[model samples]
Target chain A: MNTIQIRNITKAYNGVTALDHVSFSFEFGKIYGFLGRNGAGKSTLINIIANRIFADSGEILIDDLPATENMAIHEKIFCMSEADLYDTGLKIKDHFKWIHRFYENFDLEKALKISEQFHLNTNLKFKALSKGYQSIFKLTVALSLHVPYIIFDEPVLGLDANHRELFYSLLLKEYENEERTFIIATHLIEEVANIIEEVILIDKGKLLLQGNVAALLETGYCVSGMAKDVEDYCSDKNVIDSDELGGLKIAYILGEKSAIPQGSNLQVSAMNLQKLFVKLTEKGGI
Target chain B: MNTIQIRNITKAYNGVTALDHVSFSFEFGKIYGFLGRNGAGKSTLINIIANRIFADSGEILIDDLPATENMAIHEKIFCMSEADLYDTGLKIKDHFKWIHRFYENFDLEKALKISEQFHLNTNLKFKALSKGYQSIFKLTVALSLHVPYIIFDEPVLGLDANHRELFYSLLLKEYENEERTFIIATHLIEEVANIIEEVILIDKGKLLLQGNVAALLETGYCVSGMAKDVEDYCSDKNVIDSDELGGLKIAYILGEKSAIPQGSNLQVSAMNLQKLFVKLTEKGGI
Candidate 1:
């Protein structure tokens, strides 16, 4: 099996359940967007998958092999965490060299080339780089590693619009060059809406939705019109949320969408990914 | 004059020029989006306006009154900085009390109401709140103050979608209740595109573009077609950037858009705020 299978994983901290019987699988050669609200147990799940922490119960399998405390599976997955983990005194080039020595699949030449593309000064110490540069450095290491499954947590935390565009284009180029699984965990949904093929959304420590991006987005839509007409149309629909401005109204509806009635002044539009995520999670995690 | 006039502002750090003879005026009763890349002197200008730092040259006038070390003008302008300046040991309610005692325009009741709306626990100490909740607490204080001018620097740093929506709605409500000026310095351009009336963009420590959001967006657009057709059509336009995907090409053009040649098989669409920002800044701050 070429996949990371998470089976019934559960974790608790100080008696508070963070993950409750969560089960999911990341298949090979796909781009996934892992999304959730803050404190939604996303970090906990990522930590468990990276072998940084153990779950209270259940297990993780990378390619059908046990992942718990398994040193053999270390090279199969690499997680670029949000927190800085490099030594502040070491220069960027030194860190790259250390990574190359530690990981058998680290591509030194590719790392150097990517660094030059991002204009990252390899001679600057880790502590001397700005926040955006620090994020760039972490992503550089992740991109250079020839791992089967790589996860990026808030990869563009402090990046500006230009650098972010550059990163996305480079990521796309890398994905095209090789077919591997790339799981991105980020809050900037709109920016990644077009890049990610699949989405896994968790809320309150439980899986809410997981499916192909196109199919998931097709499951819901929005209706806008006069307040009374929109309310009447939404009465028999699965309305997630709505907004009112004077007499105008717009209601976000989930489930199989129905066609508008004839002679009605109603308008239907497809809801974007961020709006869908917000509406789904705002309803207490449906 | 109900305006904050910044005349010939200049600043440097250890001989490195951060702001070089920059001048702009922020009129009252409007919301402005202050945007720029990293190390673009945005924070330096904000700090100078908030009286946290002194400018190397020039002066700031709030409604024609000198803002330099002027204690009497303190109540007129309030800057909600990204950094945490409150005492971590104090409870959320205690901090509210302190603000009420210090600023005569502070509204304790409004602050409590806003906190309740965000589900922030007033009994918890500042240190105990999560990052999202910390942002909520800070925004609550900023929203409740009846200052004529308010500035928010990365107001939605760690906030989730629901909280961000709530904050924007609340900000609009506050603005509707009383007309005042708001200067929001943030990298999230698309989110604030509708909220801000005008935009002030800086790059390389100089003013790049400043104008109303709607008007500025009209100044640029994107055209898509075959590579040869797009290249031919862009020969006379002010093309900012172009992307080639296989045989298709999309060229981003600035300035007055001329009519497309008849039967050229080219499609035109308006460029979004984030895309415009990226293209403008990526071209070496033109």
Candidate 2:
């Protein structure tokens, strides 16, 4: 069953629309990538679903019911934003205690273990921790919340390579055990492409594309060959973008692989999500 | 001529070594990716070179002369770190003015233009800006500095996808026009791999690998084939890592691609920098 649904949701601030007729439904027990360019209303949509912000029109439903600012609905969903979650004056240990008390599903042991892995100092105040450590702290809290639907907006911002990998690994483990739904909004598309089951692309406050990850990849291909060959092959097709490096030309095109012309020496491969995002956003034709 | 040089630099805090015997020299006009796992001394190394911290031993020289907190050397090198750079009370516009007055090469017009692209509020107090906008402000300053050498430590941390791409495009344009040296320390390796001419990998306070980007890619290859074929080809080689999907197996190995046994149905491709990094660091072997 779909865990969350949004229908023709629209929001505006001072006559500037932040979300316009956005509609999508997220399934349960799957990981989804909420992707978009900057100011594409990803955060706005998430906030509206979480009931942290009001939409000007339409409806949002959680668990097949209207999702207003109801405490029960809010309890089942957790949205971890990119901004620092902890108050500046609170000590790390105190913050942990507060989270434990606030969320009935909070796993204190798991939080402690994660803190140990990250080598976080519980005595240190929020402002005293390094940026990387602060991110780790917030990640631990979010993971331990154990909500039915968890949303992470750019969760690995300050994490290093090792920590970032660990975050994904932990998410996978949690998914395997609990089967909860996860929505991740991030620009690091390639890194998480393998982990996400579905992708939803938003652009300029509107829904651009939404589908199964594998299905999207099947239709989007990157063709590389000689400049003349690529130009000729892409002339009649939807060539989203093209780039030349030395004598080789690579064109991002939308079509079946069988359509590629013979004798072109073309190497057609699935487009990495980041490359696809760049091409689509630049062309504004997704 | 080398723009910056580090010779056997070592740094410690309360007897805990942050950087150990690190040595590298950056050329005058190339983009370098300073990569490492968390706590691998990337920041320590850059901080020392920027004269913000002192090395316990060894020397840092810019233009063949020691970079010892001297105004002449400092003025030519710009280091934009993830740390907060502005006083809390100052307005964003005032901070820009302060930076313009302090840095002789700062371009006020370019800074203003970048601010507009990022949609930053010039009237907002430094402390009032969102984390993302704060990062944008710092990036704008760095772009406008126009220094001979610039070091950016995770400069795109809070930026959205569109702004991040814009930053990269602007960086390329700046490099092409001015031929300035730039060292970007980031965990988002794949995003910058295309633009970086060289890469420096660090792990646990030690240098792991350093080489030209093209040469590094040539050092290893990814071989994909049937499970048995992949296993047989990788059995006797230095298989850095391997992943299996259904009936297909892919192995990342160091050594010449031609060394693989014939009749293995092996197809070899270049290894991605990010995948290689995860394999090398996460496994603790290369």
Candidate 3:
């Protein structure tokens, strides 16, 4: 099992840096969440990794081979993205045939089976299908590839709740059968919070945090009580954010929580991934 | 307080039916989730109510008054839809001004304030902004309008996780202050599951279910045990779906939960909205 190693990656657009010499490595067989703000260069980095675009500097290595222009590693990675680079005139069945010509490991029969489960008519032209079906079609193709690394950039976009749930289940089912890696970059954090084994957080073209999902979730917690009592307790600690409901105040604290004295009128609860993400990215006084 | 009553509405495109005798109403001052799969007629019904398209038959009454091009009722309803119907050349400020010209009650100050909070550049032309910003700009305008019923068709289309969280909080904050109805038609059901007061589900151009969220959640549960034990227990019940991980079997049952004999080797867990929707719409012998 070889890992994708990204070393000192840097890219710029019109003199503005998009990736600031970032370095990270994605292991071979784990589900990871690549999170960031709207324009935080998540797509840029992903595009660079897929060799669709070039980075200004630095290198990407699939084990020991350089990734760019190397057909050896190209088949090892597949990306299901929002870009409409597909042949719109081609029917789903024809597209599957087209993908088969590009990737030797592509499975046309599996794609057809998955499309049936999604209720997607394989005879319909790509452009004729609605937005949700288009996404579903792309996902079906992506999952049919026998690649070591698959990246999904908002793969569930425009999908209804039922379809989204089906996708997650299918993803888990596939993961359980193969030793492959899935880098899912999405806006629905809570939906994937518990599913992802590892998290790579990016903000404003930089890495904010990266670690195990469980460990990161344990980094912060909420302490709630009377306004004055909570304020006094959080005076010396790193409080990420606070919520106020009438006389009650809930303050989210970062780092390890120390022992609380007896009879302190404070309630502690674990912070969920959504709350942590919101507080980390929230501007002052929001 | 008024309600948007949809009575026996029907529509079709070309030879295919879109909405088949759909009838439902969104009450004033409540947030409702209009749920459906792709091509399930959610957008068709919403378009008919917003007067964007003409229904083949039936009626929509805004407080007992016909809502077809009736200026009195039109001003009371505002829809932030996915269609790019805005003038592209106009800046954010100019668009707000244009809306103010048409909507006498449109608050320009509120729009500007909300835009600032979203960090949206108000001087850029509508066409220059990214997809996420476009949604934010639309939401800013929609929230500024003083109307009895506001409809959102995929409001958070391209927003990031942080922005989506912000939108939900802001929506609840606004609803708390105003006695207005919010009919949010979205694909991201779980995001709005807890926030929405009611749920309206549709499938195959027909009404599936509509009721309070809590009541719907209580309608089903998951029972798990050994394969034989679970199958035997579910033989006399309404089983929505079931899963088998190795020898352990899990069955999702709908309707009232009955008494289980002691040491029956079954565990019952509550069902979430997403799970219930998937089970109901899922087509197969899984």
Best by lDDT: 1
Clashes per prediction? Answer: 0, 0, 0
lDDT of 3 by residue, B9-43 (tens): 98989979998898988888789998877888888
Error at B284, model 1, angstroms: 3.4
Q: Which of 1 and 3 is ahead in DockQ?
A: 3
**Candidate 3 ranges beyond 4 A from true positions:** A221-271, A283-286, B220-271, B283-286
Docking class of 3: medium
Which segments of model 2 are wrong by more than 4 Å? A119-123, A259-264, A283-285, B88-93, B116-125, B259-265, B283-286
Candidate topping TM-score: 2
What lDDT score is found at residue B216 in candidate 3? 88
Name the DockQ score for candidate 3.
0.66
* Descending-DockQ candidate ranking: 3, 1, 2
The window of 10 residues in a row where model 2 chain A has the poorest summed lDDT is A255-264
TM-score of chain B of 2: 0.91
Tens-digit lDDT track of model 1 for B123-186: 9999999767888898888999999999887788667777888899999999999999989888
Each prediction's DockQ against the real complex:
0.58, 0.58, 0.66
Residue B251 in candidate 1, Cα distance off native in Å: 5.5
Better of 2 and 3 by TM-score: 2
Give the lowest summed-lDDT range of ten residues in model 2 chain B: B256-265
